[model samples]
Target: MKHGALLRKISVVGVSAACCIALVGCGGTNYGYTGGVAATVNGAEIQEDTITKYIQDFRTSSDLTSDDDWGNWMKENSFDPATVRDQVIDYYVENELKKQACDEKGITVEQSQVDDEINNMKANYDSDDAWKQALSSAGLTEDQYRESVEAGLLDEALEDAVAGDAATADDSKVLDMLNTYYTMFNGAKKSSHILFASGDTEKAQEVLDQINAGTLDFAEAAKQYSTDTASAADGGNVGWDAINSFVTDYTDALDGLSVGQVSGLVTSDYGIHIIKCTDEFTCDGKATSLSAYPQEFVDYISNIVKDQSKSTAYSNWFNDYKAQADIQNNDMPENVPYNLDMTKYDNSDSSSDNSDGSSNGASADTNADASATEDSSESSNEKSSDSENSGQ
Candidate 1:
């Protein structure tokens, strides 16, 4: 994770409630407010000061210091100033809602947990000054940041309590998950291809004819004639992968072939190809009994399933609670410092310039972006052990 993105992640900690609001339109009346309150959730007033501080924190952490920087950042993220204000307010409202729900369930964060979390966060930076600078940039004092961490811990406790047994992968659940993985990996096919340049079908066919007549070995033909140098060196062997991973024409040719069968001329966006199914595996039924799979792989997949189950459980609980909560997002005040004037910031030069010059930066949307970030992180982590053999 980037250092800058950490604050954004922190800012949107209890966003599941915000997602509920976005999916099923905001409930309760929008009783416009005055005198510095931004919103109210179940009679708990969310102060405008709090919202301003958070917005400023977000701006500072994101390095949107200059007016141009702010404009460019907003434009790049497809956000209008008003929408940014609303999103900040929505974050607080949702957080308050989570706090209230947690409070109702008697969930609490211990001081030790808060301290440990702060220590962990501080460890991410090089020195105490750097950590303090990060906090200052996010417009948070040590006490204020501690409070935020406590709130986060409470949210976690609430989720764990609600998820209960569903969050745990026992022996039975692990077995079921193993079967699911077996079905996918067991059915995958491995193929080798001798690729030729676009409009070189005649060359591809000539190579195929040589391989068919046994005048030239497939591996030799691939090494000699294949345009895809990466796989060509490995006897044109693209390791086992899902069918959908290949281009349409390549998939079609590979799918039609039985194990050890060579395909006819296959043309795709990459080029023309003569493909051979090098290896294939299929499970008999659902793999009801366990077969020897690496314990590490089994554990990795089990953890993933458990995490997914916890997320689903939390989503369900939050959605239910949000439906019942008497929430109200009062109108933002005109005088708040963070209520930027969209007209003053010209975003025409921004890469993501919007023709209409306005966008909905709902807090819920951040959750989706965060998920993408997490998925990208996971992909990077897996990159060392996994690779795709594109026939290009």
Candidate 2:
């Protein structure tokens, strides 16, 4: 994801496949290429155009425009075009391998499924123009987009087949898995804070005193005095998230309170805070029988639990294949010329809460570090959403 987040921003249009030849020189030649073969995975040649189209697709999805925009993104992310191309090549190699596995197994994606997916995607836009604009932004033609969707469907199907009965494990097992992931997937709380920050304890105490005496509202105190500028503007509304997303001290204090209840002075590395819980939700630490839930609810959670297996199965297959495959990549230069310095980008604003009630990026829960759980769960959650919404 670290590479993916940055690679999504940088791409080149009209760059020749010969550019790879010129850039890598002779030491990196692979598969004895004569026809712009970017790499070969298990004797299957991944064409240069394949990686190029993917680059363009990434560019479009990120809403980056023109050579200048891409150049600026390169400068911002400290990446080179060659490195971006190489990353795409690697991904394409993996994708082709997966496709091959699907083919070898005689797994075929139906035309109706692909058609339904395309229609559903089109419906998300208000007009054909808007849909076209989206495709243009993603550097994809209608046909190419359809191919991508078909590939995605095939990817899902392959994963499902590999993951086997784990998708519909008994309610107790499903619950255990759910309980394991709940801290990551669903252990979130919404709260308003009045963060005093480090060295502001005196002021923090003053604000707390005012709130206790009913003279100053928590929201007013947050806007007027909290040092965390990002959430301070929202009246210290940190939105919803698992408590463990923050430092233990901070989260422990938050965990102790009931909804709508205010806490006394609390301290953390971020500084002191008078805390108040706005909304709270929790899963029982224990898993219950399927009979305890509605059929619809059981079906829904069952789908989510199963979704986790998809990527695992795909990865296991790919890893095994890669271990034995005759892979020859011209993408990697001996010295690896690109300088990828991640600290240059502002990741502070990365958290996004979707209309579908999914929140990603930094937890808006506390203005603390992004949760480790969030990172691991986000991709699987997206996959799950796509699978669920495939025909809608």
Candidate 3:
């Protein structure tokens, strides 16, 4: 899908930009009940109330006001409410796993950290009252919001531990990153074009003929006939970009073109286009060899590579943990999907079977182990400048 289409998919969560800075969620209706169990992780029950809060929070964030609204929204978005409910459950379950992992690793989130995080989040508002009002709109009390923040922090701590041991990048990984982001490996190209929708083939051909015959300037043709209005407005200048940014067909069409040379109609996923090669140059705007690039540039690329390595390290560690987690759906409502197993160890390790008899083996379960601890008053005071789930 086009980038514009993807924006619409997530536009309902208008708070995303703020959340990126504040780590606060949109909040939800007060989930009043407290006793029923939704699921158990490593023998510890995840309360139905907690699951309800997450579901409600998700709904509020998605701009769904009620269960009915959630159902209708699902239909319009081509999703099943049951599937969404399951996803919410999974999100909560992951939180539980993070808590468990932290415990095993003897990681305790400092209360001070949480307090700092909260203060920073509050700073995003005009005043404390404004922040509280925002929380209230999301159906959260000050206390409840704090709990989510702490949970988020704990998740982060676990992730940090995992990333600390991240593997160093291999040659293949470095090459992949260079191909996508840096133009030093190969010269970069800049160009502009008029994109015609797939169905407007005839119109595209007409415009192509005009440009070839000098009857119309490329920029004017693009501004007048291009369906991609955003690029058209800039006189079809897509700006300087990595050579690999374009699809194979588009790049293939540009082959053999000299500077200021316009190509014939080129087809891509977006539409048919006339490409004008404006410039090609080294990424650093210099003729330096890869070995002679400045130390700062090398360090910059190294840091980017390290960041990618850290993510991979954490994912590998987490997936292994999930493969052995012992999870049981205890009190999910009937008609909800009951297969709660998250591990890959099922059947292979008969010894890990749940005594509760819900299902046998890792295939029927997931695993993480920590003595579940209620967030204490001290831990609740800690916070971070990172995301709601940044710690994870």
Best-fitting candidate, scored by lDDT: 1
lDDT of 1 by residue, 218-266 (tens): 9999899887887888898766554225667877788788988999888
Q: Model 2: number of clashes?
A: 6
TM-score, cand. 1 = 0.52
Candidate 2's C-alpha runs over 4 A off are 1-35, 49-72, 75-78, 168-173, 176-299, 331-392
Better of 2 and 3 by lDDT: 2
Candidate 1, superposed: residue stretches over 4 Å from native: 1-35, 60-76, 120-140, 168-290, 338-369, 372-392
In terms of lDDT, the poorest run of 10 residues in model 2 is 18-27
- Clashing pairs counted in every model: 0, 6, 24
lDDT digits (tens) for residues 1-392 of candidate 3:
22222122122222121111122232232356454666677876666665555545555555555444444444434345445445455655666677778889998889999898778667657777777776665555677667767766776687778786663555454444444555543455667778887788899888888888989999898789877676777677664433124566777766557679998878776677788887765553343344443333344445556655665678788888977999777545653322223233222333332367443211111122211111211122232112111101
Q: Given candidate 2, what's the lDDT at residue 347? A: 49
What is the per-residue lDDT of model 2 for residues 1-392, given as tens digits with 9 covering 90 to 100? 32232122222122222111111111133322233667887777776655554445445444444454454455445456776766557556666777778888889899999898778667667698877876665445677566666766786688777766544445775666555555544445667777765787788888888888899998888889877766777788765433223556656777788888888988776677777888765555454655533343345456555555544565666688778878798653333222233343334333232358554221111121233234334543444422112101
My TM-score estimates for the predictions, one after another, are 0.52, 0.47, 0.48
| Model 2's TM-score against the true structure | 0.47
lDDT of 2 at 31: 28
Return the clash pairs for model 2, or none.
Answer: 60-137, 60-138, 187-242, 188-241, 188-242, 189-241
